[model samples]
Target: MEVLSLIAGGVTTAVQPINLMLIVLGVTVGLFIGAMPGLGSVNGVAILLPVTFLVPPTSAIIFLAAIYYGAMYGGAISSVALGIPGASTAVATTFDGRPLALQGRASLALVTAALASFVGGTVATVFFSLFAPLLAEVALSFGPPEIFALMLLAFATFVGLGGDDIPKTIFSICFGLVLATVGFDTISGEPRLVLFDIQGFLRGIGFIVLAIGVYGIGEMLWTIEQTRGDVTTTNPKMTVKGLISDSKEAVRRGWKGTWIGSVLGFFVGVLPAAGATPGSLMAYGVAKMTSRTPEEYGKGSPDGVAAPEAANNSASTGSMLPMLTLGIPGSPTTAILLGGMVMWGLTPGPRLFIDESEFVWGLIGSFYISNVAAVVINLAFIPLFVWMLRMPFTILAPLIFVLSIIGGFAASRSMHDLWLIVIFGISAFFMRKFDYPLAPAVLAIVLGPIAEPTLRQSLLLSSGDPTIFFTRPIAAPIMVIALILIFLPALKLLRRKRQVTQD
Candidate 1:
């Protein structure tokens, strides 16, 4: 009854003409931002955040949240059409999305991505609305030790599930952790790995700069090397009837992937620093693991595209729980939203629901509304986006290059970051050449800083006793789970070796 009343109130608040207009406008802007290579929800939200100051608090947050949702859908567009992910979360989507596009199934891929994203976002939003208080209570119970354990679990899961080459994945994660440690220490004000000669070293490398460099510039370089001639373009006229037919077929084919992704993405999103990238990657891994036709995954499998698209969108919604309940941002984008909330004089936490019940429920309602709007907009414009692929690679490549440079520089407005992009771009080219999975490294970079601080805090609380992690009730079980995840692969390897010796 309470949930129903809140929903009713939210519907009333959100249906206002001005509020509805803002949702439409926000989704439109997000779609544009997400379609551009190297720009994702983080950039989209950051770029538009200042504009929200001019609007009402509810309106501003609603707009930003819509952008976040719409951008997730937009990220899929480029991944399928151009074999380039618009965001890190969309990287897994490219595995099968690009293949499907190449096989003249771009329409099917795009529709599946849109529909799956809608399903994921809607389901996650429902969970967010109904179970948020219960989940928030669980989240509030976690201290520094528990938080650290959770972060470790996220890292272990990603690394273990990421790829076939365990050693390479481990190396990639270590490399990222090293990069994350270069900046000033969170505990002390001292910088540990700063190159004294360069002032920018004090700031450390920006994740956005690295992401744009590696995924955007690196992809461009790889594409240039692989292209023999003009890129092949397919223009399939998808009628409404055909689209409806294909959507039903896609849902039938991808329901399992969609459900798995939605559940995983939601839970992962609730954990601090565990964002859509890991959620999507884990979803794709699970989809592949459970697939009867696993060999078709990296080919043109529809489930591959559906799984990650669903997971990323669902995770985007899940990341909001901490921000609203505990005043802790679950992801980078939510961190920005947290800042926006503070700037708007609205404090985020349990009081947020009590004091600003209207805003809270209204934002929840907007998720359902905006998700439906995004799917409709993406479906309606599929033909135009597909037509965009007709441009020559020679033309598209340089454009992507320029956009990547601009996006990198925009990340921090530092020339040094641009230089870092060039350096990392070159490095990523080689990494790709060596077949190293970049996703694990990227995940490490995001989680390392959070994990380090939490670990230190936990230690300080326990007088430097490392056993604190294993002694706490919540943290202990979580750490045990992480251990199981980490050791499972090693156990498999050892068993294989023993079998070989016995033979």
Candidate 2:
């Protein structure tokens, strides 16, 4: 009851004209930035963090929080419209979002993403308000071994992202893992796989580079080759009735995934370093894994679109809990927010709730408001986004090319990355032609950096005994489940072979 009273008071604080105005402004700015390739919530929050200084600290965090919330929603827009994930968090969204777009169901995909995001954000905020302190302790429980086990679980779930070709999926994941190891050794800090002694390899391959190359350029190439310049998506109608129907269909089809992602994403996001990207990916994998119609997952399934969209937004909210209560940032954006809090003469930790109750509650209250604001603003812009889809293939191909090149360069400002993007793009086109799933590769590169360090740290903690993963109370179950998931596809494949032989 006391917490409810605080939340009510916090809501009142967030409703003040200044805060509400900032909420809308921040969400709008974030929406567009997140829609841009190579830019995500980190870029949006960092770019505008300077502006927050002019306001009071409470208002500043709310503004940045609004942008963070909006960006989560915005990230799905590019995934659906351009076939490129607007943020790493949205990579799973592309698994179905892009397919929906190609099928002229972009409207349905966008609507599902928006609704799922709202639901997920609302659910995570409720969790945040109810169990902030307890969850922070749970986050603290994750040591290197536990974290590595969790990463193992993530890789196991990753198989769900690929086609039924088990060996091909394994190959794709291995390829990605190798690419993930191209940079310096996580502990030794020495270059390990610098091909041709290129100094740029030290920087390693950015996920955005691979994502843009594979989804953006490679998709473009595949489209041109397939259609031979005769591609056209149905011009989506954006009337009020159309939106209502899409909303209903989204709920009918995607509700299960929305709930799954909201719960799972929040849980994952509550971990100290596990952020929205993995949360979204894992959510997508689970949704597909659990579906009776698993084969429908990558082919414009509304549930598939909903899972990742919901998870990313929920995880973004859940990430704030550790930052507010434990002085640990659950995500990259929250890390910046933590820094901003310190700059404003406030400390995050056990005392934060008692000493800075108003600030903490105000931010949480703003989460409720910003979710409403983002969905409403995003819905209003649906027509504009869909309009882009109507463009002829000739015009759209060049646009994709320019955005891919610009996004790669802007993220790192490296000519080497630029060249790699081009090379990867062409390579992706070939991979596509061969029917190898690129999703596993993308997931690997994203998780590899995090996985490598934790695995190495876990091994060191156990004196190089691999049994550490199976001995720790928390790690053991996760490792067991991960191992099962890794073998599940192969088991199914072998069973099918046996049946065929008997026939």
Candidate 3:
């Protein structure tokens, strides 16, 4: 009943003209950005975040959140029409999507993707609305020690489960933690990492600057380096009649895959630092495993495209759980959202529901509106989006650079931040070259500050006894989980090495 009332109040708030317009605009822009190769939800949200500075907090969040969902829908376009995935989350879609396109069934593939995305997003949003408040209520019992333990768990999970290269992930996270310590100490007024005679260093690096540089500018640079010539897409002639017919076929054939993706994606997304990429990949694997025609998975199977599309979209919604409730971001895109919330002077956590009910509920309400809007907009504007794909990278690359520079400068109106963007962008390019994950670094930057303060407070509360983290009943279990996550990978590596030696 309480959840229903909040949902009702949210609906009432979201229907306002200004908010509704923002939602449409956000989805449109997000679709365009997401359709462009190398630009996904992270880049879409980061680049546009500065533009939202002039709007009200609730409206800004609603707009950004809309873009996030819209991009998930748009990513399927490139994956199906071309072999290239528009977003990392959509990579799994290409296995079957491109094959279907090659087989002249692009319309069926696209329709399936769109419909599955809508189902996944809507179901996940409903789950978010129902579960977030309960999670937040439970989180209210967490003190500083528990919060610290949770942050450790987040870092551990990402490092352990992110990729096969644990060392690179650890290095990325440690680098971010070091970056987090560069500015003034929150407990004390002392500046820590300020270089001599550099005024901007005192203000520290803005999250927006880092986000735009690493995701937007860095991505553009990589795209420029890799892309050789004008890319053309398979333009399948899609009519309204064909679309309606294909939609029915997709639902009939892909319903099981959709359900599998949605359930797995939502649960994985709820885990801190576990983003959409794994969820989508896992869903695709599950679909293939269960399919009677498993041999068709990589050869234009509709179920192949449906599963990943459904999972990625659902996971996108799921990633919002920790960000909204515990103030921990599950993905880089959510990290940007968390940063935006902070910039708007809104503190995320259990208290957010009580203190800013309107903002929280309003944002939640906008999710439903945006999910439906994304499908309609994507279907209606497919031609235009395909045209957008034909735009030269030479022209698009410079435009991205300009926007990234503008966003960096807009953060604090500082030239220093622009320079920082350039530095970070270059660093990110090199990191990408070495196969180091940027998400962990970004996550660490967001969580590092929070972890430091929480740890300090816990120590103070326990009268300098560090065992406080393990003494509390709730904190103890969480810490144990964290420790297990941290060591499991190392243990695996050790056993592998020992087996090789024996062999």
The number of the candidate with the highest TM-score is 2
Q: Per-residue CA lDDT of candidate 2, range 213-296, in tens?
A: 898888889888998977766555778899899999999999989999999999999988888888998898889888889899
By summed lDDT, the worst window of 10 consecutive residues in model 2 runs over 158-167
**Residue-wise C-alpha lDDT for candidate 1, range 1-503, written one tens digit per residue:** 99988987886777678778888888888987898866778888998999987889888999999899889999999788766677778878888888887676788888889988999999999999999978877767777898788777766765555444778878888888888888788778888788665889888875667667776777668656766645555646667776887788788878888888888888777776666877887788778768888778878888988899999999999989989988989888899999999999999998889999999999998888889889988898887777666566677667668877886776578899888888887888888888887766766776678778888999999999999999989899989977877777888889999999999
Lowest summed lDDT over 10 consecutive residues: which window, candidate 3?
Answer: 227-236
Clashing residue pairs in candidate 1 (N, C-alpha, C atoms within 3 angstroms): none
Per-residue lDDT for 31 in model 3? Answer: 82
Where is the poorest 10-residue window by lDDT in model 1?
Answer: 228-237
Error of 3 at 108 (Å): 1.2
Model 3: CA > 4 A from native: 135-237, 383-503
Residue 25, model 3, lDDT? 89
Give the lDDT of residue 306 in candidate 3. Answer: 89
Candidate 1 global CA lDDT score = 0.82
RMSD of each: 2.9, 1.4, 7.7
Ranking by TM-score: 2, 1, 3
Please report how far candidate 2 places residue 217 from its true position, in Å. Answer: 0.9
For candidate 3, write residues 343-443 as lDDT tens digits: 99999987898999999999989988888888898778755544443456566456556656764565458888888888898988888888887656665
